[model samples]
Target: MVSLIIFSILSLDTILNVPELKNAHYGICFLDLKNDSIIYDYNSEKLFVPASNMKIITTAASFYFLGKEFRYKTNFYLRGTIKDRKLYGDIILQGGGDPYFNLENLERFADKIISMGINEITGGLLIIDDYFTDERLPAGWSWHYLDAKYAPEISALSFNKNVVSVRMRPTNAGELANVYIYPSTGYVKLINRMTTTTNSENIIIYRKPEENTIIVDGMINIKNARDIDVAVKDPAMFAGEYLKERLNARNIKVSNPVARIRTYELFLRQKQPVLIDSVLSPNLLEIIKETNTESENLYAEILLKTLGAYRYKEGSFNAGLNAVKEFLNICRVDTQNISLWDGSGLSKHNLISPAVLIAVLKFIYNSNLYYDFYNSLPQPGKGTLKARFNGFSDTLRAKTGALQASSCLSGYIKINGQDYAFSMLFNNFVCPIKKIMQIQERIIRAFYEEMRRTNVDNTELLKPVEVIQQ
Candidate 1:
């Protein structure tokens, strides 16, 4: 059986020794976990930005420290008195930076208040959103992305990701863009007055903000469209405005007023806080699923915050990094080459070598979360990797990373019923987009095909080739 396996390995190596692929400006490493062996490697020690693939590390660290049952809690407190089933004092909403807060959840939370038989509030309504302290957004994130849906800055009191979808439709006369907010609240202030052209009216332009203002710079191509979607600057403010209207509509009258304040002063309110209700987020497991499956930046950022708050006992980025570094040390992995700015690899300064990633992958594979970690990756023909592997998604499983001039794939591959952990990263490749993707596909296919054939010598297949001086 051993001889046959060796022969099979050798044959596979000979097949994979191709000029086009071998000479490509890329780095890769394939490890046979079943036997604790290196199947193949080429420049795998070179460091490169992992892009969204960095989510894997963040997710793993989260799962390790936070546990799967963890849930972010948003609490409502009452610091005043309720007279005649009315809040005679102040109503406080304390938010701890739950990134998953949404309109539905906020509405449901408000509905719970209605269920409490409180029809009128004689005191003021105050919201506290100072949960997270990090002011630095991810590094290298495009300034234009602030207007895009996914790149909004992380906030402590975020509501609907501080995003509001505005539907912009062209007028019947074909000259005006009619903007409509989906949950149409009267609070949001539109900064740009968009004029719609007949040809550009139908396009749906997504806008997010880097600061307090979100501007819609793109055109929606749809004509006679009654609405379009755009992200707002402050979710808490929008939620507050919408909630006020909602309460008013439900016949809940308020005499004190509405505002946002720090939670530390809850003691100073006329009425001390009474725990009205609590809302729980999806379990940590599902959040991890979202993180790995969709590479959700919101989820990734929240994980980092959670790490800072819980693991290191410090509510800051430095604390988060300290926690991550300590965790890496425990895993016996080197931390010298990595400089992490954010849990999401959205930061350009984020760095790690293919070898370090492989080591991390192997550690996770050998740890208690072996199967769970592997299962979280997008299958080739499905999830995010659906278009990857030339549509042969079933036979491959790898974490893919992509940034301008930097494309990468790293994870476990199940080729011909045998599993192999691999990391393939291409950085600084001055190739065109199509050619880059093609090169990636060819490399993946070549590795898959080579692993299936026999006579492959794992060590020999990965031997570094000789370099000639210029």
Candidate 2:
């Protein structure tokens, strides 16, 4: 039999409603999913910056509206006439906001063009990207993240996630490092000032705003292990250039040798290009796993823009948010307290209460899409949580978010065979984020230990003890 002191350790009051957490600047809401009763609540109504926790709401809308089999299609249009196996017109590449459009996909696209029996292009490649609005970066995104790999420009036709990977290694102990860029493009200029040393590797790259030049300023250890990924300025152009090179390698000559986006007004007024081929992306279930498990900001934004385009016939950020609002209204989640500016919650302007998250979670639980929705969230021993929450209850499935001093976790946990929706938010903590995560894990462990102590195996004693009283 478990010791009775477990009771002293198990009380919800001792764990959550306490003094130390009073200064934690956090909000929490726990609800019994089966009974629809509040199990624990502390300032759940108060709002705070949600960081990437906003992904939870965006994800919910994605699955609900976008469906499980949704796939983004990028169209290839030929604008020139083919005579004597030679094309004399521009090739228009159209993007539909596919988030996983990597280098492999670009190579495939290039190969498809080669297979069409066209060997030369007299005109340059013109990309039509009117599917999304003119906005590249969301409003209120901090300038610090502007140059970061995680905060690349969101575009309907972005390639390689709009990131350039640079790898540098020292030739000798005291020599300068050798640098390399993927896709072998000269669009980005790399300034190598890093010196090789036995010292620890601290080499870094900083992008100059509004410029394609990046400065490498630091000392690098001889054993440079990892590659550096930095945000690119113009994703559509970068991708176009990459495709142009691929076409050249395959013996397809692109005369201008440059890839640029077509003007929105010109694209609308120009005649439609000849349809060559269209590439369809992977299914949405896979996308959901990528978005929720890996917490991909780009995928979330793409889904948001897609939702807006589907509903309002425009892929603007405002249209996407309005579509999300419409879905929230359908779910009866009050929108009065919710303020969301970006789908990925990269912007600190996003403010949402724990109660709102819990409500949406409960609403999903009642729907037929529960299995797909449940499996999409990162479990304790899976996805982003593979290294985190190890050996913890597998029943814990949730989304994690962080930005500067703000952090959040929200999801469902099963205790004593009863499902419960929970959200925990912490803001402005000066301590290390690892410590904050430790606290969150400790609270979850407490909940698990408490449920285990009162766990009953006998069907006759299943009066639900704690639940019966409620």
Candidate 3:
């Protein structure tokens, strides 16, 4: 009995004295599912800016509402008649905002079109992108992001998420040459004379597009640039132009020059979307893994917008937010203190508390999707958290959130061989970000050390004791 009493006192002290956690503007909470325990909690209920941790809530709602098996589809339909392999009318390409559409897929589509045997078209190409209810971009999305490839505007009739790729290569003796686009689309015409000096970081920039112009600026290492193809702006136009070029290569001729044509009708000659090839993405389970482990902005955006498109009966950002709200209400998550403006948590207005986050995790754990949900998080000391707790065991699995003045870590931890769910968030800290990171690391390490000294047998009595009375 004496040992029990002493251990209890020590555990309580350790819980309250978590390093760098005291009086923090942020909040931290720990819940042990195995024993129904709240091992340690400080300001767990206090509201704080959660940053990308916001992805946790958005992703959970998305998984619940969007279903795991859902795959976005882009369709090609023709309105006019096809006579003797010749399209007498216009061909229509309808978009369903497939975020994963790529050049390869587009080319396969073109190949299918070529296989149809119609070499000439009397009418032009028409595109319909009105799948979503709204055309205005997400509120508070930075203008700078408009031009950046990752934050490409959400479009229902999206092709390659409305992005293109331009590459540069260096040849022998300090001269640079034009690089080839994988699915060469003439939507963008390159006039780059920029050269890269040896032993220097390559510079590349995207110029603002003119009324039908996509410009690329900057220099790239000829060798390194050849490795990976980055996303470009205006993927639809690029894709359309590329298809035109490939058709021309096959002796197919278009009556009109390639241009952006926004029409709901498709030329009858190209009504059939012949399936030339198909590329399946990593499953929803795998996608969530990439988002959590790599904190990929692109994936998060895709999933969020995907959620919006699925819910609210429309595939727009507002629709997605409506779906999120409905899912939270259904799950009984407390949203009084939560506010979100974007799915990626890139917006500063997004805010959440440690308690709310833990609540979300707990709710998901108890839900029917528990298995797929749990596996989506990074393995402790492995994926995102690999470098986090250096000295601690590889038992911490959590989502990390980072911004200029904000840092957050929330998820589950297995302390002293005992499993626990936890959340630690810091925001508006005046201290240097380096120091805050140091504090964050120390706090995680302390949880393990404290758990090691406590008795797993008496975890019940110690559960509620961790949450201090406000």
Best by the TM-score measure: 2
RMSD of each: 4.9, 5.3, 5.4
- Tens-place lDDT per residue, model 3, 1-470, is 12211113244355445544444577777777776656666667777878788778777886787667666667665445668888776555665656666666766767776877878777766555666644535676666556565466565555664655555566543665455444455565555555654555456545464333334344555455542334455455555666667777888777886545443323333453332344455457767777777676666766777776666556667667777777777767666657777777777777777877887888887778766766677665777666666755456667888776788888776666666777888887666666666666666676566666767564534433332222
TM-score of each: 0.85, 0.90, 0.79
Which ten contiguous residues of candidate 1 have the minimum total lDDT? Answer: 1-10
For lDDT, candidate 1 versus 3, the one ahead is 1
lDDT of 1 by residue, 108-217 (tens): 76787788789888766677766666453555666756655566556666777766676666554544466656676766655555666656443535443434433444
lDDT accuracy of residue 157 in candidate 1: 64
Task: Give candidate 2's total backbone clashes.
Answer: 0
Please give, for residues 1-470, the per-residue lDDT of candidate 2 as tens digits. 43211112234455555444556688876776877866566668788898888888888998899899989888777876787667888787888888778888888778777787889998888776768887888778888768788888888888888888877777787777777776578778878787788977777788899777778867787766557788888788787888887888889998886655644633453555777778888889888888999898888888888889989999988899998888888778788768989899999888889988888899899997788988899988777677677775467898999888887999998766878888989887777777777777777777666556665532222222232221
Candidate 3 positional error at 234, Å? 4.2
Worst 10 residues of 2 by lDDT: 461-470
Query: Candidates' lDDT values, in order?
Result: 0.68, 0.79, 0.64
Tell me which of candidates 2 and 3 scores higher on TM-score. Answer: 2
What lDDT is obtained when candidate 3 is compared to the true structure? 0.64
